[model samples]
Target: MLPLESRRDMKIYTFENRTIDIRAYSSAGGLFTALAEIVLNKGGVVYGASFDEDWSVVHRRIDNVADICHLRGSKYVFTDINGCFSQVCADLKDGRTVLFSGTPCQIAAVRKKFGYHENILLVEVVCHGAPKKEYWSLYLDELLKNQGKTQDEIASINFRDKTKGWKNYSVCVEFKGGSRFIQNHRDNLYIQAFVHDYTLREGCTKCPFKNPNSKADISMGDFWGIEALAPNIDNNLGTTIAIADTAKGESILDSIACRTYFSVEQVAQYNPAIVKSPSVPLDKPEFDTTVKAEGFHYAAAKFLKPVFDSRDRKMSFRNQLRSFIYRVYSFIKNR
Candidate 1:
């Protein structure tokens, strides 16, 4: 196995004759701009998650390159491999150069299922982890209940909105009636709780892929604390940090245009601890047991309830406080 640390900071690597780097923040336009560079220089397909018409999840295949415009943003849902694995694997088998973007586990799953197809390039997010499916179900249920609408009435959802920043980061839920419900990230208790334990996959916490062992050529995530490191870069506009893990990864960076690339040394200097240490273990006990369990779904559902319930109470308290504040503000303004 390659020394895991070798792939820690974004470097470049080559896969299936194409080169691309995990990028630092590229604007909504920047994502497509980079993909366009890849397709024009070396014809290939781009695959990533996109929001469906109903705001559900689907794997997107962009052969024309222009279609990449559809998959921009941090909130493209359904990072789990369960729903979209077969389709993704099939595309890999087709032998076209493919850029598969997703959370690490989903990338790992595709790598495991398809093996290393020479033409496939895997790009993973620096994921905080994923929320439990139950939490999402309950959240949507609560939303529907509050709105007096059915699940089908929901049209789209955006989990992260840069216009609002993280605190005001809102989930925009649209309805069939053309009305929209903008729930602040804080208002979505289940989502907040889910973020805490979402990296539930057994192998993920131990994350063989967390380092260079990852099959992906490039890794992408928010350059948290970027301001401290790249004081020159305007993070307020949002930055996507890319860590190229291999030579092919480096080549991709060379190929892509529009992104303001930073050096690995600069990235390490910004996040000294990440450079100083080994990749952290996944750290969740439930994650260790779920994979070996007879039924992972049943086991996860059974084990995660207590954790979610405890969070629910805390969320409820916070919500009440918010409601009280809103009401007081309304009363004063009206008077």
Candidate 2:
């Protein structure tokens, strides 16, 4: 039998209404905004992942709406907890409501570390596994070199920048020089390898958290297939797919103002990460070997270009069909 955390008693929804300033990262139906507003209204604290000046993903405490807004968007890498659990417990014990978000493994770790707290709300992302921090560090260095900027000059970076729209997301990096670099996921070697699962951590391939039932009060992810399910709701900025896994989670959804309910099967069909782990990257050994002996750039050029090219071609063919499906789903959903 699946563990209790792996069980799926969830209510899915598409979040649409969003406040204006929060639109940047809240593109996916403003789920983060909704969550943030709830925490703020309760005078609670938010604990979520954000990037350091050096571009490493790490968890931090967010007290104000401005800081919580930073927690929007995906880091697309493994984030170290770095005592976030201890802090969350501390806040909850102080009678503050806490909204904690992370990958399912991180969520499980939080559960193991702190047991249960009524004031704490756990939100887990449908993760695609994590790559070693070393790989990301190296990739960032490569970006710095390409941009001719020092790590200290970096002002911000968004891995899931929606400038090109959601389906064709890009990485946008800002520097103190007022310079910005934006490149599509397919064009970026790091994202290419990431999306293909070539550089994921070992535990990810056999992750135990890939069950429909999760320990988190809520589960959230991009509504990747929203066009098919609710065409009227998708405007390309992004749409969010949120699942309330517990009664607490459900209650919070009931209180939120603007949202559209969806079926569990409809959501699961588009997002398998909710129930299954992705296959291990076939070229991980080669990637490891070449990356160790040569470097990230050389290894990526050699091992990843062909893979990315193939994916580009495949997606190109399917884009039209996917569009059709979205229209069909919208028709059905509205009717």
Candidate 3:
């Protein structure tokens, strides 16, 4: 079975130097505004991934809260950053108050690269896991192929549309063909396969970053129960469940003055499942045999063959087919 498929409840915790609750908040805008406010107050730049002209990933700095809008609806898995952890470590060593946001794995990579720093505030999103980058590339390639357009023909892409509800998020692709394709989530088969864990990184299946004891100061996730608890808050607009994992997180939240926010209980009614589920152990092996080259391809092929075809194909036809279907569906639905 896939790792995430386990019906086990994920554990989330709040820590403080002394306080019990550690102070929680709700409201997506309030959460972002709070984080942005703290960064600006410290004269520190908020460094996170943002979309560039090519629709690829790049790290960007935001000096003002208004710039936070650029990061809204960013996919939890894929980040728009160049280089790897080494580059990120170089930036952190410069001693800037930086807010790094990404999936738990990427955040863990950054922490592994730079170690823990008081000035660095790591904010991790609650992620299931990221799909393979190759899958994404192939999916986009197929999309352009189906649309009769080249990479140069694409103007831009937006994965999530705020105007629409989260379940119906659409992928807006503007083609050089001067045509636009706003594919709905349901029409995309690639997305379905991905959600079903057909294209996740092998490491992700046994991820090391699923730790509630994470080094992040603050962790954020969609407030699944926003409507039921904070009925006053705009549930359709989305809300973030901000948990303070450190004193720095509390300090940051205390400094911001914005829209109304609430405690964890305020939104607990919306998601009893996650609230009651036990946290999984974060310990994981160094590598998974399925995706690693050193592992037996025949054994891996045996498990994946049923999904596609288990022939002695060089590229592994079964795996590739599974990947292709997942990529196409994910690009359309999850984006």
Candidate 4:
């Protein structure tokens, strides 16, 4: 099969039929978890980004059904797995199927390390650029200080908490005692910085592995314009935009025992980020300076200026209009 961009018949879909629990907890439609299940069921080891003891995002290995939950959600911070690169190499050498997932660049690095191994399935997220882990640490420190809580008092931190619903996903800091802190993206500085691309790494500005370049088996992300693209399945729960680059990629997608839906054409305008690198916010340098001098809190308060999520509303309206015109054009052309 050709690259996702070069091929007109690229396989793209939302894993609507994925297990209910998995879909409910996932960042987007539980596609990764579903895929991970397939590999795990086959006795393969899955490697993915997960939060560590300090709530720092790091890539870890998952081999059992119980451990997949840890690798289930999205972590916006940068993660390096060079330490586990050799471990993955050993896993592959020992004739085990390895499902390695990460941001596009991390996938590229792993793909380079292993060359073209048939047993190694490279799955990359449609990354929005990884923010530096240092900033994430700073935010946690501030959150702890503000709440008068310590890291030990927290049980888990979910960046994509869907209690309010997927489209309006919030950040949830669950304490061990049962009480938790939840904040919507509108009020969440860390999420706003990530969404506005103000906290992303410098390399993400001109990402080399933009679209057709990543060459991973499967690339997935939140189906941003799902309301316009696949309305029937748009439950405001969660949906994923997925694309396959190679024949194996397509095969892996075909193996999914889920209600897959959509076409490549319907997905592109909805999620051009899969094809384009994240644009750098103009104040990123100043934001970085502020962050280094003060902290993520000060920098975010000063720089992350989003006007009441009007951009999301505007983008949705524009997507609906674009889809309407495309439908009209297609109807007339076919007639």
Please count the clashing residue pairs in each candidate, in the order shown.
23, 7, 13, 0
Q: Model 4, 1-335: lDDT tens per residue?
A: 33444566665756653567788889988888888888999999999999898788999998997999999999889998888888897898889999999999998898888866889888899977889888899999998998989998899988888888998989999999898889997789989888788878889978888666875888888888878866877898787767776767777777763335566555767776677788887777898899889888888977854544566788899999999999999999999
The residue-by-residue lDDT of candidate 1 on 68-103, one tens digit each, is 545655653345556556665666566557777777
The clash number for model 4 is 0
- Superpose all Cα atoms of candidate 3 onto the true structure and report the RMSD in Å to 1 decimal: 13.5
TM-score of each: 0.63, 0.87, 0.62, 0.87
Give residue 189's error in model 2 in angstroms.
Answer: 1.0
lDDT tens per residue, model 2, 1-335: 11234334445766655564455565365687678777977789888878876689888888887677678878877888957767876887788988888889988888777666777788888787777788999888987897788889888888878777777888889888688988988788888787678788888888987756477877877777777887886778777777777767777776773446566677768877777787876777888899989889888878887876787789987998899999999999999
In order, candidate lDDTs are 0.55, 0.77, 0.54, 0.83
Candidate 4 has an lDDT of: 0.83
Instruction: State residue 40's C-alpha deviation in candidate 4, in Å.
Output: 1.2
Q: What is candidate 2's CA lDDT for residue 149?
A: 88
Candidate 4 regions with alpha-carbon error over 4 angstroms: 1-6, 257-265, 306-335
Candidate 3, residues 195-260: lDDT per residue as tens digits? 445556666655655434455666666666555555564435445665555666655544542224
- Better TM-score candidate (2, 4): 4
Where does the lowest 10-residue lDDT sum fall in candidate 3? 15-24
Query: Which TM-score value belongs to model 3?
Result: 0.62
Where model 3 places Cα greater than 4 Å from the true spot, the runs are 1-42, 52-54, 58-70, 76-94, 176-178, 257-335
